[model samples]
Target: MFNKLDLSKELTGRRALVTGGTRGIGAAIAQRLLDAGAKVVVAARTRSDDTPAAATFVAGDVSTSEGVEAVATQALAALGGLDILVNNAGGGRAFLEGSWTIPDKAWHDSFALNLFAAIRLTNAVLPALRASKAAAVVNISSAAATMPFGPFAHYGAAKAALEYYSRTLAMELAPSGIRVNVVSPGVISTPGSDEFARTTPGFSTDDWTRNIPLGRLGATEDIAEVVALLVSGRGKFLTGANYRVDGGMTAR
Candidate 1:
């Protein structure tokens, strides 16, 4: 039923930047965009061969202004211009002491990566995105933004604000033809998520699968596929929306 959507060259000639794209869901997104003929750029603090060999690598952290500036300059220079931006670099260290006793530095780091990084990077790329025929911005949020549990208040609060900011940003950028949206993924199996399964209380992927309506944890490819569609012409009419890729985890 979904086959009518021709994505053979949906992103041809496009320039895309995926932050924290060296691994996990970000890696999958980068690969999909590259396969669709986009000039993809993957950005992170470090480099490894695992990065899509075809995509240009921009090694810069997104958690600080200096890093963001470096990434913005290098990306624009490398790609000449940009059309798709995926603000997918966001994660927080555990509040080992206690959720309420989370350190000030942890809070600052969380906001920097989970919220402000996207803000700063988006502003830096606005001019370039504005010049494109159809620009798209997709922020990778977490299902925790709406359903928080156990020491995630800090991350959840930041992502919640991110969603609100994205909605407002969408309103402001619509006239300029830049679409802003959010993708909230839930329990996707990745190296980063492997620890959660073992550490987080009762967070067994095998058990959760039966509880999740889909009867399985999501794959990185699931998110990659949705993001591919969201940034392509197929989603030309969508903006200011928060899409959940959870397997009915939130429904229950």
Candidate 2:
């Protein structure tokens, strides 16, 4: 549950864009930024009831170059300029018998969604990002990148590339005062993950909890809170860093 009292004006006057912000973790992050006083544009292929009413919604996919351009254009037009960019549009295909059984298209689609989308969108919005006095880019990754789950090999590999890209981008943009960071989440409780758990064989939410030091799946709000802080002045000094919000799963 998100605490309404957690709102702050720390991001006042900032403009932000969150990809795949219609539902789940993306929705939570957009809402948190709005609550923190930032003008936000939420982009997705479709809008849902869960879409934050306070955010300007842009209907565009981020998985292709054209989609990335459309989304970046509309989001920039909506906000005038961008200060914070959250590349959160990402997901893996259904669980396969093994990585070898996964088709070539699945690998391409995985990289398109998890890696290329962020790369293209960042390139599209580079001008606006560079123009801001306090710019930040937060790329959402996954614990699978480090843990390397056999069933989600493509996803893990793409996220691993994204993390490396983010670090290198951070180094290149540091002198310009732009900050880039990665947030890698563990098994999180969301409608998408819930459905995946139910449909995938040999994957149990209970089993996941037993391995987590916190003894529970993470909430979307948990990821949202960290994102809000990272995009705000509170995380001004942080760049090229990966914050794993995994309840100590990676620590173990």
RMSD of 1: 1.8
The superposed Cα distance between candidate 2 and the true structure at residue 164, in angstroms, equals 0.2
Q: Candidate 2: where are CA atoms >4 Å away?
A: 1-7
Lowest-sum lDDT 10-residue window in model 1: 1-10
CA error at residue 105 for candidate 2, angstroms: 0.5
Residue clash pairs of candidate 2: none
Clash totals for all candidate models:
0, 0
Q: Candidate 1: global Cα-lDDT?
A: 0.89
TM per candidate: 0.94, 0.96
Model 2 Cα lDDT, one tens digit per residue, 151-242: 78999999999999999999999999999999999989999999887888887899889999999999999999999989887788999999
Name the regions of candidate 1 deviating beyond 4 angstroms.
1-5, 96-98, 199-202
Candidate 1 structure quality by residue, lDDT tens digits, 1-252? 357755767789999999988988899999999988899999999976668889899989899999999999999999999999999988875664457888788788899999999999999999999999989999999988998655777898899989999999999998888999899998799887888778877557788688679888999999999999899988999999999999988878
